[model samples]
Target: MTDMQVQRHAPIREQVANILRDAIVDQRLTPGQLLVERELCEMTSASRASVREALRQLQAEGLVESHNGRGTSVTVISTATARHVYQVRSSLEGLAARLFAEHASDQDRAAFRAAVTELAEETAKGADAAALLKAKSRAYDVLFRGCGNPVLHQTVQTLQHRVTRLRALTLAQEGRAERSADEVTAIADAVDARDGEAAQAAAMTHVEEAARVMLAAAEGPPSH
Candidate 1:
C-alpha cells in the first residue's frame, strides 16, 4: 500500500488504535483475551510499531492491560465494578445535562436534536450493536459540546472505553433501547426548554436504568 493509504486521515498507529478500540468496545475482543503484537499486526494490516503504539493507546484508555509476563489483554469488568462506574457516571452525566440546559446555544441545541433523531432512526431499524454505538457516540458529542465544563467533559471521556461494552449490552436487552431513546428525547426536550433540573433528572434516570439492566446481565445465572 502507498503512504497515502497508510496515513489517509491521521497516522497508521491512530488508525490501528481506533480499530482495536472499536473491536474491544463491541466485545469482538472479549475480556482477558490476549493481544499479541504479531497477531494484531497481521489482523490489522499494520506494522509492528503501529500495532504496539495502538496497544499502548488502548492501555491508556483502560481497555487493556499489559501483564508482567502474560502480555496485554482486554480488562475484565466485574458486576460490582460496573455498578460503581454507573454510579459515578450518573452523577457526572447529570452535571453535564444541567450545564447543557443552562448554557447550550441555538446551534448546540439543533445539533443535539439532530443526533437524537439519527439515533432514533437507527434504533427503529434494529441497528446492529456497532451501528448503535456509533450513533450513541454522535449523541454524546452533542452533549459534550453543549456542556459548559471542559474538565467535566474530559473526565467522562476518560471512562468512556469502560462503558462502551455496557452500552452495547444495555441496548441488546429487549425494550431497553426503546426506553433509552425516550430518555434521550426527554433530555433533549429539557435542554431545549432550558430546564436544567429536568435535564439533570432525565439524564440520571437514563443512566440508572441502563446500569440496572447492564449489571443484572453481568450478574448472570446463579450457580447450582
Candidate 2:
C-alpha cells in the first residue's frame, strides 16, 4: 500500500498521536505551549475524540500535561528532570549496546555500522537538527533491533519522545553534533568487535557526555 494509504489505515488516534509527538519532539510545539483541542482537531483533521485520545497518549508519555481549568500544554523539561532522565538512559542504552554487541548477527552488525556511518556523514556535512534526528533515530533503530530484548525495546520506546527532545537540544549546541557522532561511532565500533564491556562503556559515556552538554546549555552563559 502507498504510504498515505497505510497511514489512513492506521487508527486515527494513533496517527494523531504520532503527528503531535513529532511536532513536540521537533519543537514545532514548543515547551509550555498550550495545545487546544479544537485547534488540534482542525490541524489533524481528526475528530475531537481522536484528538483527546491522542493527547492522553502523549500525556502518558510525559510529552504533554493537563491542568485543571487550563487544558494541556507541551511539557517543559527542567534541568533536574533532564539529569534524572539521562541517568536512566545511561543504564538502558548501555544495556542495549552490550546486548547488540553480544547477540547481533553479522548482517545486523553491518546494517548498524552503515547507520552509524550515515550519522557521522550527516554531522560532518553540518546537517540541520531534523536531519540529524532522523539519522540518529535510524542508528538507534538498528541498535535496538539487534539487541534482541523485547523488554528493553519496549522500555526505551516509552522514554523515546523525551529522549529525542533532549537529543535535539544537544544537537543544537555548537560543536555537539560532531562530538555526538564520534561517540556513537565508538559504540558502533565496539559492537562491531563484539566487545560487550567496551560497547556498554562507550554507550554510557555517550549518554553522560550528552547530559553534560545539555545541562551546560540549559545553564546558559556563566556569570558575565
Candidate 3:
C-alpha cells in the first residue's frame, strides 16, 4: 500500500512474468499447462500474491488464460493470430530496417556489427537450439534499437513475444540455421552499406522465409 512497498515488489512481479513468458515462448509449458499459484510461488521464490499478480498480467497479455476451478494455462495460438502477427512483424521490421539504414549512428553501427559477428560465430559453432535462439533474438533486438523509433520498436517486441514459440520451432528446423545466418549477414551488409532499400528487402525476405517454414511445418509433412 505504501509507495516503497509497491516499488519494492514491482520487480518480483516482473521477474515472475518474464520467467513464465519465456517458458511459454519456449513451449516448455506447452499449451494448457496448468499454472498453480502455489507451485509458481515456490518455483519463483515469491509470495502467492506476487505469483498471482504475474499470472494476471500474463493473462492480460494474451499469453495465458484463467479457467475458474481449472486454474491458469498457457494459451494456444490460432492460425489467424499467427498470420496477423507475422504480417505486423514483417511490416514493422521492414520499417525498422529502413530507419536503421538511414539513421544508425557510428556507435549503433559498431554495435550491430559486433552482434552480427557474434551471431555468425555462434551459428558456425553449431550451437544448440537455445543458444541460437538467444543469439538471434539479441541480433534483432539490436536492430530494433538502432532503428530509433520507439513505437515501432515496442510494437515489434510485443508481437515477437506473442509468437515466440512458433519462431523457435521455425528456427529449429533443418537448414534454418544456415538460412538464418545468411539472412543476418545480408541485413548487416545492407545496413553497413547504408542502403535502406536493400535493408528492407533483406529484412522482409528473412521474415517471409520464416513464415513459409512455419506454415509448412504447421501443415505437416507433404502428403504421402
Candidate 4:
C-alpha cells in the first residue's frame, strides 16, 4: 500500500503520535510550546480522539507534560536532568558496545562498518539535523541488533526517544557533528578490532562528549 493508505489503515493514534513526536524532536514544536488539542487536530487532520490519545502517549514518554489549567507543552530538559539521562545512557551504551564486540558475526560487523561509513559521509556533507538523526539511528540499529539483548535494546530505545530533543541540540553546536562522527568511528574501530574493553570505553566516551555538548547548549551562554 501507498504511505498515505498505510497511515489510514494503521492505528490512528500511533500515526498522530508519530507525527507529533517528529515535530517535537525536530524542534518544529519547541520546548515549552503549548500543545493545543484543536491546533494539533487541525494540523494533522486527525480527530480529537486521535490527538488526545497521541498526546497521552507522548506524555507517557516524558516528551509532553500537562498541567490541569495550562494544558500540554513540549518538555524542557534541564541541565541536571540531561546529566542524569546521559549517565544512564553511557552505562547502557557501554554494555551494548561490549556485548556487540563479543557477539557480532562477520556479517553483523560488515553492516556496522557500512553504517559508520554512511554516518561519516552524511556528517561530512553537512546533512540537516533530521537527516543526521536518521543516519545516526541507522548506525545504532547495527549496534542494537548485534548486542543480543532484547531487554537492553528496548530500554535504550525508550531512553533515546526521551532525549531526542537534547541530542538534536547537541548536534547543532559548532564542530560537534565532526567530533561525534569521530567518536563513533572510534567505537567502530574498537568493535572491528574485537577489543571489548576498548569498545566499551569508546562508547562511554561518546556519551560523555554528547552530554557535555548538550548540557552546555541547554544552559546557553552566560550573561556578561
Q: Report backbone clashes per prediction.
A: 0, 0, 0, 0
Residue 141 C-alpha lDDT in model 4: 88
Relative to the true structure, how large is the alpha-carbon lDDT of every model?
A: 0.86, 0.92, 0.81, 0.88
- If the candidates were sorted by their TM-score against the true structure, best first, what order would they fall in? 4, 2, 1, 3
lDDT string, candidate 4, 81-137, tens digits:
889999998999999999998888989989998999999999999999988888888
Error of 2 at 120 (Å): 1.2
- By TM-score, who's the top model here? 4
Query: Candidate 3 has which clashing residue pairs, if any?
Result: none
- TM-score: the better of candidates 1 and 4: 4
Pairs with steric clashes in candidate 4: none
Q: Which residue window of length 10 is worst by lDDT in model 2?
A: 1-10
The TM-score measured for candidate 4 stands at: 0.93
Distance from true location, Cα of 37 in model 1, Å: 2.0
lDDT of 3 by residue, 36-62 (tens): 777676566778888889889898888
Model 2: per-residue lDDT, tens digit, 125-151? Answer: 888998999999999999997899989
Error of 2 at 11 (Å): 2.7
Q: What TM-score fits each model? A: 0.92, 0.92, 0.89, 0.93
Stronger candidate by lDDT (1 vs 3): 1
Model 4 spans with C-alpha error above 4 angstroms:
1-6, 222-224
Candidate 4, after superposition: displacement of residue 162 in Å?
1.8
Residue 145 displacement (Å), model 3:
1.7
